[model samples]
Target: MVRNPGRRAALVDAAVEVLARDGARGLTFRAVDGAAGVPNGTASNYFVSRDDLLAQVAGQIHQRVAPDPEEVAAVMAAPPSRALVVELVEWINRRVAGDRTGYLAMLELRLEATRRPELQKELTRTIRAARDDDLRFHRESGLPGDATAVRLMYLAMTGLMLEQLTLPGVVPAEETQGLISALVDRAIGPEGAA
Candidate 1:
């Protein structure tokens, strides 16, 4: 396989597009190559197999949607509280909203994982690790609540995103901010902590 980082990244990106538009079953090497506008077999050269492509798509999406360093630094500089938590949630919501395709690809992977035990195990570990990271962040910030709070917040945000992306009008756009604010309030407790 070629060691060209740029090319590999492009293939992964194409895979995400395919996964989002066609779902897991359509995420083949040829499909990625076509979506990437690369030569036939190019995707094969970059990814060892479909699973590798799926994993890379997940990684690329994570990187794409990760908070900006400047944003994180600014937030970190402030004291952690319910308001901070709300801002963070809003920031994440905005990012995910902007990258609907990437998030959709991620959801597709989740469905695909259900039928693939090995993929299911890997994704579960990855998701758990992300939850751990969030829990650590909350703990370090001295935010209110504990790991359960973090987990609940994560669940709320995921559900919100799913609705926002799949059936946007199900919850009016104006109500979303209010709903998230309430979720954060409850998740962090009466003190707005965590």
Candidate 2:
């Protein structure tokens, strides 16, 4: 594969756009090249196959949506509680709200994975790693939760995000923080006295 980080990144971003707008079925090398505004076959040069492109897109989605280091540090510095968990959920929700396209592309990747065992394995591995990381962070941050609690929070947030993104009026944007707060409190509990 070509080793031009800048170009490769651009192509991947373009692929994300295409995937979000057109779904996995519409994600093709030519479409990505066109979306990237590069010459024909540029995407193919960067990604050898469809699965390669999809896998890279999976990795890129996490990179694009991850919280900034400073934001993470600030949160981690605070005493852990349901409120802190709510804050984290709100942070992620804000990102999803701001970049609906990227989140949609991620959902598209999930659907595509269902039909491709190779991609499914890759996604399962990556998602497992992320879940494990979340568990570790929860423990280190003194968050009042176990792995199962974390998983439940993840599911709830995912559902909330999907509804908010897919059916905008289904969950009022202004109420999202409150909803997250409620979910987190229900899943964990009130903060310990600081």
Model 2 spans > 4 angstroms off: 192-194
Give the whole-model CA lDDT for all candidates, comma-separated.
0.84, 0.86
Q: Distance from true position, residue 183, model 1, in Å?
A: 1.0
On the 0 to 100 scale, the lDDT of residue 117 in model 1 is 86
Q: How far in Å is the alpha carbon of 28 misplaced in model 1?
A: 1.7
Cα lDDT tens digits for candidate 1, 1-194: 79999999888888889999999999999999999999999988888888888778766776766778788888778786677778888888888888899899889989998988877888788878877888898898876667887899899889988898889999878998898888877876655232
Report the poorest 10 consecutive residues by lDDT, candidate 2. 185-194
Clashing pairs in 2: none
Relative to the true structure, candidate 1 reaches a TM of: 0.91
Model 2 lDDT, residue 194, Cα: 28
